[model samples]
Target: MLVFQLLGGDLRGALGPGWEARIADPLLREDIALAAAIDPQQRSLDARSLAARLRGLEPRRAARRQAREQALQARLQAWRRRRELRRRRLGAGLTAVLGVALLATGAMYLKTEQRRQQAETATAQREAMLAFVTGDILGQADPYDSRSSGAAGGGIRAAVDRAAARVDARLHGDPLAAAAVHGMLGNIYFAQDAHDRAITHLEKARTYALASGAGDPAGLVQVETTLCDVHRIGGHLAQAEEACASALEHARRAGPGARHLATLKLGQLRSEQGRHQESRQLLQPLLEQDTLGTDPRLRGELHWALGLSARALGDYVAAREHFGQLLQVAKAMGEDSSWLGWAYNSLGSVLVETGEYERADALLQRAHEVFARTQGEEQIETQMPDAWRAEIRLLRGQWDEASAILQRIRQAWQDRLPPEHAQQQRIAASLAWADAMAGRTEQARAALAAVPRRNDPAQARARSSAWRTLRWSRVALALDELERAGELLDLFEEELAQELPDPHPLRGETRCLRSEWARRRGDAALAVEGAAACRDSLARYYAPGDPRLQHLEATRAAFAAAP
Candidate 1:
């Protein structure tokens, strides 16, 4: 009955009130007789006694039922507490998982957006750089178009200045575009012969190009090669050689065309440095290449360099051939009048050196006319031919005529060039020579003094010193200062030996002077031997029956007939 109550049993409710009367009728008669015999109190039982007993049992059952109800309520409370705790744990875990997922998604979205923005920014920068460079290129004058007028009536220089500023402002953030702009500006400056400015910008261009990954190797090579040219023109030979070597290294990796350009520049550099044999060796291979002949400008430059090297080496025949080729190329191009004039002047100079005075005079005159018409009279090109004409006059013993021509050239060069410029110094040396030839000893000394001394280590300075010493010796000889003349001659010979090869024309000229000095000293045997050697050298180098050869022959004859 207790287990049934605990399980919320209905066993007591299923027993009806008649269930006790039926159980008493079957076996109660025998059990009651036995209980009455054992205890006489069972016979005296009444309805009041049974009522009291039932009432007492009812209280106990009520108390038991109350305790069971309390236990069930306690179990129900415990089950509800466990269910709530499980629900709270599940909710907390779900919230944590959701928060982490949201954070990861937000971070990924932010990163993607940042990348997209950066890409867009890069695209904008590239487009802006392209527009800037294109605008600059279009605004500038055509480099090859000689007839094209200056920009906005301010001249090409003004236009370049404006374009340069714009490039700096618009392309500052884009290194590659900035390099290209700088290279273009450098080229313009180079064409104008503003060597310092050209070098500055070209170096900047090269620096930026390297920093920008050197995407265009050919462009870098061009920049370096132009730097080499600027340094060479400015007489900074060591810097020029460094630039040329760098350009050659880049050109070799770039392609054949770039390599060819670098090779030609190196040959020109070697020639300027007085390494004629090396220059010829470097340029000889280019002449045989079909690619070299295809580009007229390159072909002309190669021929010009070869001609100079050959002339320096005293190979007059080879020099003349190369100059002729250059002239032909210049004519075939017919683009720049300056090129044609330069070709004529170079060929004429070679002819003058070989003692073909008549032909040289004709060629030089033609060059003078061409330059005067093309580059104007005040230009350096126009003035150089006059110097060559003065040389011819001096060679013919027209000392006054040569001196007058040199005076005009000197004045013109002074007005246009720097005081210590190489061309000006050379003109000064020529003036001194002409004055000495005309027997103006004091004036020759004064003119030589006016020629500035070059402390710079350059081939030009060496040549200047040699020429100055030669002129000083001539003046000393005219004054009959034999000891001073001998000293000057010795210095001249030393400089010549250092600066020029044994077969150089200037060496032969030095021998002729030594012969004259020997004759004046009354050493007849020494004078005859010197004169004979000088004549042989002149005959071997100069054209047959040339005026210089005849002069040497006359000197030899005079020495033989003297006592």
Candidate 2:
């Protein structure tokens, strides 16, 4: 306000002092102002005339500029309204997106937490199971305890039973743990050859492992593998086969190790079922690929199973190689004499089949000595050597010696074997052959009938089955039942045709029997042909100095010279 006052407020034409010179004619003054406001057109014109004309042009120009400004203002308001609406829509979309993101994040967090809690609970349950087994079961093995002292077999079984009794209460709601515990117990009983108890516990274990809501693939595979082994040993072959196949199916999902283990066990079962070629199909790959891996025990078991298949297929060289590998593995592992005894016994059986009698007898004697020392004289293993010794006697044509040995072991076999077993059938067949040789015609017939005939060609072509049929045919020939002998030979030939190679020792044995049948039928030419075939087949397997070779030569000469 002071500055405004000091500047002579509103002083542009104030007329303060000497106002007379600044004053002009009223009309002239108006004309001069109009001259300044308007562009200086017609400067010489009178100021009154210019003012009158300028006033007339100003209204029209102002009206036109006003109309243009109003139109531009209306366009700006329309654009502003559209921008506002777009901003609101973008804001709403962003809000919805943020809401969805928040919901997804919350759901993810809940899922992660739930899985973490479940894993922790499973871990705790497993730890609890380990503690229970270690503390509750194994800790009960105290000799000083009254219960341990009184219970059978130092209370190992009693302790297992006690632990099993508490499993429902202690490990409730944890079916996986229960399955593991029962599977372990069943394996324990299986190791001890307690088939009935093993079956009960294993079935229970499988039930828990295959439970609908709590199925455990690893547990299922392991339980089935063990059940296959136990069932096969207990002579329940069909059940064994079913269990083995199921184990393999589950093991495929489990892993390669599980698959290989299951396969090896199944191969052993197939061998027992007398499906020798099928057994080889499953087992030979394990040998060729070396898939049993670095576990000596598993490899050794595979070798033994392969040997069985090879021998049954009449591949003596392959059988020897497999058994030889088994013995080397067993010896390298520093296995007990019992395991060595089994290996030696396996190789010995092959030696017998190939007509290496001296080597076979030596190996069998070593096997017998080992069995006597490690297993004692009364054990089933002790009887294995005795059975093979009878085979040796029969091979040497000492029927009386073979008969005496078989008779001595009959009670032992009766004690150990089930009502129907391959080993039992083998024994019965051997006894029948020996009895037939001794001229006990009626006794041989009854003994031969007592041994069940294998119907499947896969079963009939096996080593034991072939030998049984050979015995049967020989008995028929001795009784002058040429027709029956011919039929038996035909069956044998059909079985061998399906599986055995041309140069197999089984082929040699087949030829020998055919020659005998042809000689009896007075078909001299066929007898000569069969004798020559026997010589060709047997030469590969039998030692040059073997009595069987010399016998084969004599037989060939006799057939060729027949009238």
Candidate 3:
């Protein structure tokens, strides 16, 4: 029987604090004492015998005893009721007090958070003011000396970290502040080639900016724009587009000039999404606008993008001219620009395409030094210069150096960028070429197989480009797969027939692959004929010392000297 008194549980802790006094009232204590003194030795008087004795002697005495017993019973019941009421009141009062205390704690926490945000906002304003002034001073200083801050190699990073700590301490609870902090952190992470970390921070900034309310429209747009860039770099096309759309909306709401940056970002997003026509349409008008009214760095960047887009669309002559203009602008502005390396790298790429390998190598090498000195060994996207340098090494037949550079690029891309990114695919393909040259056929094939074959047309094009240059040609030659090599040659010929007219850019490449295939099959006559075809194409399309022509010459010479 689970009687309340015999229950195996403590009541004091359940009642919270101050339960002892209510349990120990005088009347309550007396009730407990009387219960404790319920003795077997004490007898209950027999009322019938008392009544009988009272009838003969003292009936009034029996009545008096009965009245005393009734009074005792009433007193015991009253004490028990008061004790139960006091216990109930104590419980209710304690619960109410604790609830109030919790509410007070929550209010204090919110107030502290608000104060912290205010302090952070004040600090950020101060830092922005300082940066503006310092940047102005640096602008006026000698261009080369402006880069030599007291912090030197790691100093800029150290300062950024210090500022980040301040932001964290003050703005951790403020959504807008956190968003700004996230964007700043993402910039540093991106420079360090820590794309995963950059993505994390950019995502945080995006979420926070969306929820940061209607406070600062410009700040919100900036965060969103930065997130869009991160998504593009990380190869999250859909997410990048979504972020750009939101940023555009914010820009529209913020009135004039705000949309300039949003427009630029939208153009970038469009370009990545393969909406090249739209991208060009969006950016061309802005580029035509007076350069004096816009940010010089942004102007340079826009020009660089236009040049790249032109190259992608196969206007190499126009791309070279556009890059030249961008390069001059960056050089003239000098310290006022952050796009110096970009200009150089883009110029170098166009030069390489135009068969100016020596100039391309020199420009790309300079760009590589600038990036390495400024951003360290990270920043893989910004390391286009380094990739070009490796390409140059491959062209020069510096097998060991090319192989090492390609290995580093593959590792960095796999570690930092999404595995399916076009840049990553291209790097893997290049590394596969290096492996093929180094006589690691199994490794080369493994690398080639890992390149994804998605249904997206742009991805298909990119894969095809990498496949033709890296796998199809090299693999067929190494494996002596003449039939497959002929099939690939026919496929390329068919593609060019649709995509372009006669004298296609890849004609030399196609002929070279076929020549290698014929040579591997021990058909000297067919090898010489294919090599001659490639030589003729190369002579028409490329410079005198182009590596493809040299390789073709070597192949022809070998065949002629054969016994």
Q: Which candidate ranks first by TM-score, i.e. highest?
A: 2
RMSD score of candidate 2 (Å):
37.2
Flag regions of model 3 displaced more than 4 Å: 1-178, 212-214, 273-278, 291-293, 332-338, 378-383, 411-414, 451-472, 482-504, 507-540, 550-563
Q: lDDT per model, in order?
A: 0.68, 0.71, 0.62
The pairs that clash in candidate 2 are none
Q: Which stretches of candidate 2 lie over 4 Å from their true place?
A: 1-173, 212-216, 335-337, 369-379, 451-464, 554-563
Please provide, for model 3 over 10-84, each residue's C-alpha lDDT reduced to its tens digit, 9 standing for 90 to 100. Answer: 111112122223232232233333333346354232435432432332234346557976997899799679857
Q: Cα lDDT for residue 512, model 2? A: 87
Residue 359 in candidate 3, Cα distance off native in Å? 2.1
**Global Cα lDDT for candidate 3:** 0.62
lDDT of 1 by residue, 393-488 (tens): 877778889889888887766655665555666667666767777778898777654433433355355444455567666666766777767876
Give one clash count per candidate, in the order shown: 0, 0, 1
Against the correct fold, how does model 2 do in TM-score? Answer: 0.69
TM-score of each: 0.68, 0.69, 0.60
- Residue 389 of model 1: what lDDT? 79
The TM-score obtained by model 1 is 0.68
Give one digit per residue, the lDDT tens place, for model 2 in 423-520. 77777778878888889889987765553345546444434466667777877776667887887788778863555556667668878888888998
